[model samples]
Target: MSEGKKMTSSRRLQLKSLMLQIATKRLEEEKKEVAAAKEAYIIENCPPPDLSGDMAALTEFCKKLHIAIDKIDEGRYDIEAKVQKINKEVRDKQQANCFKL
Candidate 1:
């Protein structure tokens, strides 16, 4: 490639890398928000009974919370995987272009 074309390609690659980093950071923040929301949901909707001795009910509440949290985590994991895959693709493309230059 010509010098101008190579410089442009390098700049484009840098932009892609920056964009991917921003997206990854945003996803991480979103995951944290989801976790906080799950915790809040559990607290708000499944308050412990006042019996002070009902271990069974407390355990059941905990179990339900665990299931909900797990589901949220699974969804976040899927999103993260997709972001990572896209990041990898961008990196691969950038590397290939670099080699061509």
Candidate 2:
């Protein structure tokens, strides 16, 4: 392999690695933001039912809270899957480039 070609390949790998690192950091920040938002939403909207001797009302509130929690979990899973997909694509691209050299 020529010297120039080797340098170019090395630079490309460095750039790819930097990009992957930045993307990973961004994904982590996004996940943290989502978690914060979910926590805030739960705090603001899912207050405990008043224990004023109303069994039916308390049960209904509990049911609603369960549903909300389930939805939040599903949304978080979906977001995580998307982040993983992006990470996988970056990894695949890096592998392909490595094989090219």
Candidate 3:
């Protein structure tokens, strides 16, 4: 069964855009919540700044943080490489078109 009233192309586009915006906002909220929870967990389990006495705990956290940061750095490099490849492909396509004219 179909509705008596059909939606126009513009209306469909508007609905899709609105849906995307709603999804993006929800994702942002979830990311913020996850970050807050992680921070809280770290504060509760990790030692305080006065680790001047228990250097062991400080050292462990440093090692853990270094590993996490290394992963982020690797991801950053991967994204940069992907972006450069995409741009090069686009430029190559454009140049190919120029040769035809």
Candidate 4:
């Protein structure tokens, strides 16, 4: 009986170790996937600046880029606000329906 118990314990330990290894591997894979996605996003949305230009040209380029970024940020904020308002309305309706039920 004692030998059987030892075997069971050993098997459980082995299974637990295997599960941990698998979970660690999955976490590593997810990290890699996230990193690849981040790299792709940066490549697509954040173009590298042209460093071959004169100081004046570079300054002008930076000024234009900053203005464009500000505009994009404003648009994003507006859209986010709208989405939040819509979500709140939906939630309120859901709660009202739940109370009626």
* Most lDDT-accurate candidate: 4
Q: Can you give the lDDT of residue 53 in candidate 1?
A: 48
Give residue 64's error in model 1 in angstroms: 0.6
lDDT of 3: 0.92
**Positional deviation of 46 in candidate 3, in angstroms?**
13
Question: Per-residue lDDT tens digits of candidate 2, residues 1-101?
Answer: 65553567889999999999999999999999999999999999878657785888888878988998999999999999999999999999999999999
TM-score of each: 0.45, 0.51, 0.49, 0.72
Per-residue lDDT of 8 in model 1: 77
How does model 1 fare in lDDT? Answer: 0.91
Model 3 lDDT per residue over 1-101, tens place: 98699899999999999999999999999999999999999999975655554778889878878998999999999999999999999999999999999
lDDT of each: 0.91, 0.92, 0.92, 0.95
Better of 1 and 3 by TM-score: 3
lDDT of candidate 4 over 1-101, digit per residue (tens): 35443567889999999999999999999999999999999999999888799999989998998999999999999999999999999999999999999
Superposed model 3: Cα runs more than 4 Å off:
1-53
What order do candidates take by TM-score, descending? 4, 2, 3, 1
Please give the range of 10 consecutive residues that has the lowest summed lDDT in model 4.
1-10
- Candidate with better lDDT, 1 vs 3: 3
lDDT at 47, model 1: 80
